[model samples]
Target: MNGIIGKKVGMTSIFDDAGRNVACTVVEAGPCVVTQVKTDDTDQYNSLQLAYGDKKEKSSTKQLVGHFSAAGTGPKSDVVEFRDMNLTKALGETVTVDEVFTEGDKIAAVGTSKGKGFQGVVKRHNFRGVNDATHGQHNRQRAPGSIGAASYPARVFKGMRMAGRDGGGRVTVKNLRVLKVFPERNLILVKGAIPGPKGGTVILHK
Candidate 1:
């Protein structure tokens, strides 16, 4: 369950050894600092608290400043805990992208999907409203018709699909193949698209 915090660096295509075009999402992972090492005796559980990216000193809280300072590092923009990390590392240690993952490894990326604010059922829930334009149906093509029954259940069902806010939620994309690893650049190329828009933060779990 080793993992690291990263930023989605957009997508690109590369040719494999077989000359097959492979679509991959580029991620700038790590050089994460181990801010804290929690043990069962001290914290009632075992986990590694890692911090990555950079933040302005003025923008960071006093508590956060003290926390990273304890690790001999500056303010970090993202922090995450990995409970199942097998390797033992001391606080203030650095973890890189290539140190945990390699080419051909299968990984899972967790991120927030792009927000589609106030969407309709047609796009949100994939509702095919009023297939036919006839029967005097004018602008009801994308409408969610008849939310509830008239007599039996006077109100709409609790889980009924309707138009509302969409996306901008935590999403996990599993089994993404690790196409390549650039240790020097701290970049990892993973096959297939990952959640979130460009520059969004993502956690790569191996």
Candidate 2:
């Protein structure tokens, strides 16, 4: 099908049988429980809600506890719904890493990028500032040069690139190769990096 909920378990480099080193990101994939199944007739769409990682009963909210109860599972620390899944023969059943993917499979990862807060035009938008650094340039060295023509429109256009927040948004990287799949440990090693920090949650799709 399309998806799996996984945890980023840091990165490592391993040598292949050919004695070539490969860089990979190890991820703890599944052993994920099917918490809820949404069907077209019943829920107006088709999807499966998978839950991973456990939490104390006391730490779970009533709604989450009830959701888990419906699935005959314990409270999970994370639950993500995957839509339009197929090639997954089991629903309301535990899905292990082996069932979803294998080595050398091509997949995509979606994650939130790391945040870079309150940056200037130079850093944020890559604007080239005043070139005359020696001729009394003063503070215009880092300033946004010309916002607009002097009097034509007389206003800065909307959607002009300016200093602001960067990152911390949904980013998808496509065509990443699966370097390894360890079903026993519920781990999958992708050939390259995914987004976000070390422990961020990422959704992998075929």
Candidate 3:
């Protein structure tokens, strides 16, 4: 997918052309610099590696410094690649939200969901616990009930759904329409809620 690495600037509402209020997520999409470009002849594939954000030179590792040095740019806080881009050039370039996308363009936003630590079966997997509270089930309110048929396999199945960790996983919201694009600020206002918290890194794909 052709896209930009951005930070979620939170969400707000804006009026459309017809004066209808539209809920949108504001993202600080790149003014991303082209750090490296892979070609079919050399790397056996085509891709453009983009670098964004700023990092302190003193704190950067040698490998990262080498990578940034190869780009002729200082060390960046983040780096991501857009594979098979439609550009003819190689490196030392910039791509903003305005260049590849515009208002009404269908897009997909990918981000990591908020972490919800060790949860119960009801909350994590939406499993219905013991429904009858009055039927001598004093301690069965949040219980997962019998895990399986007794002694059938003499052990819990490997793939059986149970309570554990939830959330904090990769999530993608697809077919999101771009409500507006601010070229000067390199911002993108996309329709609807995106995964992850405010100021979180998100990949906007088209």
Best by TM-score: 1
lDDT of 1 by residue, 1-206 (tens): 88999999999999999999989999999989999999999999899999998999999999999999999999999999999688789999999988789899999999999999999999999998898898899999998888888888788789999989999999999999999999899999999999999999999998
- Please give the lDDT score at residue 95 for candidate 1: 91
The lDDT of each candidate is 0.94, 0.86, 0.88
User: Which stretches in model 2 have alpha-carbon errors above 4 Å?
Assistant: 55-60, 87-92, 135-138, 149-154
lDDT of each residue in 1-206, candidate 2, tens digit only: 56788888889999988999989998888788998888889999888889888889999999989889878888998888888887454445897878888888999998889999988999888888998888988889888777777788889999988888988999999999898898888999998899988888888889
lDDT of 3 at 193: 98
Candidate 3 wrong stretches, greater than 4 Å: none
Q: What is the descending TM-score order?
A: 1, 3, 2
Cα RMSD (angstroms) for every candidate in the order listed: 1.5, 2.5, 1.6
My TM-score estimates for the predictions, one after another, are 0.94, 0.85, 0.93
- Tell me how far candidate 1 lies from the true structure as C-alpha RMSD in angstroms: 1.5
Q: Please give the lDDT score at residue 130 for candidate 1.
A: 90
